[model samples]
Target: MAARTITNRKARHEYHVDETYEAGIALTGTEIKSIRAGKANLQDSYARVENGELILYNMHISPYEQGNRFNHEPKRPRKLLMHKREIMRLLGQTREKGFSLIPLKLYFKNSWVKVELALARGKKKYDKREDIAARDAKREMDRAMKNRHRE
Candidate 1:
């Protein structure tokens, strides 16, 4: 099966990602069907270490239309599978200095569902403006260079 990736672009703009980790997600049967149909949303989704286990919250997977009473909850907390040591390390970082664990994306790896998690810090308003300015400057320079080469 082809690998499918669903990404949260807003997370990149709103947070400074310092590190990334891949983790397996515990999904229900109907939820998996919904995800395979590209009906999952990572926006506003985040992970936290709870009781020594990582739990994902606010992640929405639309209920399968074909599913009747067996449909899964759209916004249920899901467990993430990771090593004990990794979870412990992330717990420390997330507790300090306005750090958080955000889910960057979800994808299928050889039929198993995986999430791309990040250790991130929230971006300030000025930092966001600076990044926009830099991006605009780079675009303008590239346009200038292209026109110059054409002349």
Candidate 2:
């Protein structure tokens, strides 16, 4: 089967990502099935280092259709597996003002489920405007280049 990836599209537009790390996610059997079916969401989700462990919060993995009473909670807090040292580093980095941990993508790595976690800072309104302007300018430049090539 083709590997599936679920991405947080708004994360980049809302935050300035500094670093990313691939980490394994701890999921229940039903949750795994749900994710395999591409029934997960990363919107309004974030991660935190609590008691030396990386825990992802607010990520919504819909319940498995056939799970019955065995279905996992759709918005349960999922623990992320990483080396202790890496978790420590992330903890320290997130301690800085305005810095936070956000999940950028969720996908299958081989047969295992993995999350692409990012260390990011929230962007101000002016910063967002500047980004939009820059993107627009780049798009126009690309269009102009394409027209020139055609001519």
Q: Give candidate 1 misplaced runs (Cα > 4 Å).
A: 1-3
User: In model 1, which range of ten residues has the least summed lDDT?
Assistant: 1-10
Collision count of model 2? 0
Clashes of each: 0, 0
What clash count does candidate 1 reach? 0
TM-score of 1: 0.94
Instruction: Give per-residue CA lDDT, model 1, range 1-151, as digits (tens).
Output: 4446889999999999999999999998999888888899999999999999999999999999999998999999999999999999999999999899999999998889999999999999999999999999999999999999999
lDDT of 1: 0.95
Kindly list the per-residue Cα lDDT of model 2 for residues 1-151, writing each as its tens digit.
5657999999999999999999999999998888888999999899999999999999999989999887788998999999999999999999999999999999998889999999999999999999999999999999999999998
Candidate 2, after superposition: displacement of residue 141 in Å? Answer: 1.3
**Best-fitting candidate, scored by TM-score:** 2
Residue 48 displacement in candidate 1 (angstroms): 0.5
TM-score of 2: 0.95
